[model samples]
Target: MSPRIPLIFNSRSWNWAVFAVLSCSLFSGCALLPRPRGLARFPKGTPATKAKLEQVKPGMTVAQVEAIFGSPGHTSKGSSHDNPPFLSWTNEDLTAAIIMFENGRVTQRMNAGGLK
Candidate 1:
């Protein structure tokens, strides 16, 4: 009886192996990676300081919040069901400033790491 050749030695199998490797490398580059979500090291706008964050009120408008915290480092567009549009700010110290907006007004505010 003749022995069967290994599957990897077949041309079809070899092509699939090369395709898989190229696919992985193509998608793994930094160009396809999401940007780092953090505060700008040197902010060109208003800084997210403890004092500024304190001024954010639940009823404030988006413009009002922006006035206090400046442009957010990250802005997430939320859905209507459970999520709402939100803004985020961060600092070099890893302190995070987040604000949720509903109907274009502030609905929630969260601070983690306690900005100083």
Candidate 2:
């Protein structure tokens, strides 16, 4: 019977192998990571805040409001729903920066949000 040879990795080769595995694991960890709850979409333009919400007064035209808050995420009233296109801008789910209009002017501005 012939003697069998056993494979053994030297210390330097073992270190390189460990380093490669760790590097791959680090990169894969980043890719598999979950996005944060509110930061996923990462809003563009001005973020919805109490100050910005207060700035949006009733009677401001949609154009003026757009100038301030940028495009609305979603509006409660449309042209069909509201002749003047009463606007609503919700930054996140179940929350809204409410801007109301009547008589071709801003009627009410309200902030609606369930999140704390």
Candidate 3:
């Protein structure tokens, strides 16, 4: 004749393991969440100030332009000697504009977002 033995497992151990994993995951995800860099660094949709825009003029040098408008959105110098340089300013809110210079003076101003 053979004798049979019964086995016992604690369900609380499984519950504890699950709770620990969930707690760790929740805390870790919160720690990993991205934080805002800062206002000075510029974020999306930063408004353009009239004071800054007024400082720009057609014939101003690149350095002068930077002083007035911080830094340009972009700059490009063409390979062809006949081509003039360009400067662009952009609002993070999708407001777009361009100022064109000829012989170091502003010759044209374009605004796509209707800025006067």
Candidate 4:
């Protein structure tokens, strides 16, 4: 009986094998690739929410609230003029707040509850 032997490859096959290995490596834990860059990210939650919320008072314009908390992440109707029906903001930490407005002023602010 004849014994089986491992098959050998030519130059082309070796190049393809090396290419396949390098290609896969380029994506995973690869030192050869450059680090990805992006805009600086900030947390979404209202830190010192109590203080900030206190700053917001009924009859303060949307702009006034924005000055304290920055622009809201979202709004109920997406209306620039008639907002405060409900303005909601989310933070990177997932801490959120929903401000209720009446007569174009902040009436109340509530923590947009997070996971239990």
Candidate 5:
């Protein structure tokens, strides 16, 4: 009877040890799981105002263009090859688009989905 009791106790303890190890391994695996990507910083939606589409004539400066159409949605320095350096503007919704000259004039303009 004494020997049987010891055997049973040992079996129970071994089962508990196995359970603990499996639980720890599962929890650690979850920690190693990959995280999802973050959302875009810019707001998302269609352009509320109609896009203005017009030819951008040469010699327009940056400021003058902004005056006619208000401020641009976003602006950045022109690329190395883009001549007559300018900044681009898009509507708040990012649908409408325009480009202004470095001197503050409208060099190019396109409306609703015109520029890709």
Candidate 6:
């Protein structure tokens, strides 16, 4: 049988292998760091500001409004194609905003409870 080769940790090749593994493990650790909360794209249960509500305008679609303010908290009784179906959103403080839709497009917007 052939003689088995010995591994010497002091050798240059062994030192390079150790260094490469350490460098890779150190760099990979950065990926596990937590991101800052302020950078969140969408925050849940956030109050709608007046400026956000103002983004809703006449002629915008129901889907478009939902994209801006999320889903409506309340919907008036009417069919989707009704002459003036209403959609409304309310914050925890009871500040509320309303939108009127006709033919699947915005007709008007109203707000109450000092939205700002």
- Please list the residue runs of candidate 5 whose C-alpha ends up more than 4 Å from where it truly belongs after superposition: 1-57, 79-84, 100-107, 112-116
Residue by residue across 1-116, what tens digits does model 4's lDDT show? 89977665656568546644543343243334454576323433334255576677777877787788765443333355565475656543334555667777776665543412
The lDDT values for all models are 0.63, 0.58, 0.51, 0.55, 0.46, 0.64
lDDT of 1: 0.63
Alpha carbon lDDT at 56, candidate 4: 72
TM-scores of the models, in the given order?
0.51, 0.49, 0.41, 0.46, 0.36, 0.51
Q: What is the lDDT of candidate 6?
A: 0.64
Candidate 1 — number of clashing residue pairs?
Answer: 0
Which stretches of candidate 3 lie above 4 Å from their native place?
1-47, 72-84
- Candidate 2: misplaced stretches above 4 Å? 1-46, 114-116
lDDT of predicted model 5: 0.46
- Candidate 6 C-alpha error for residue 6, in Å: 99
Q: Which is the leading candidate under lDDT? A: 6
Q: List the residue pairs that clash in candidate 3.
A: 58-105, 58-106, 59-104, 59-105
What TM-score quantifies how close candidate 2 is to the native fold? Answer: 0.49
Q: Ranking under lDDT, best-scoring first?
A: 6, 1, 2, 4, 3, 5
Candidate that beats the other on TM-score, 2 or 6, i.e. the better one: 6
On a 0 to 100 scale, what is the lDDT of residue 79 in model 5?
A: 62
* Model 4 CA lDDT for position 34: 51
Model 3 TM-score? 0.41
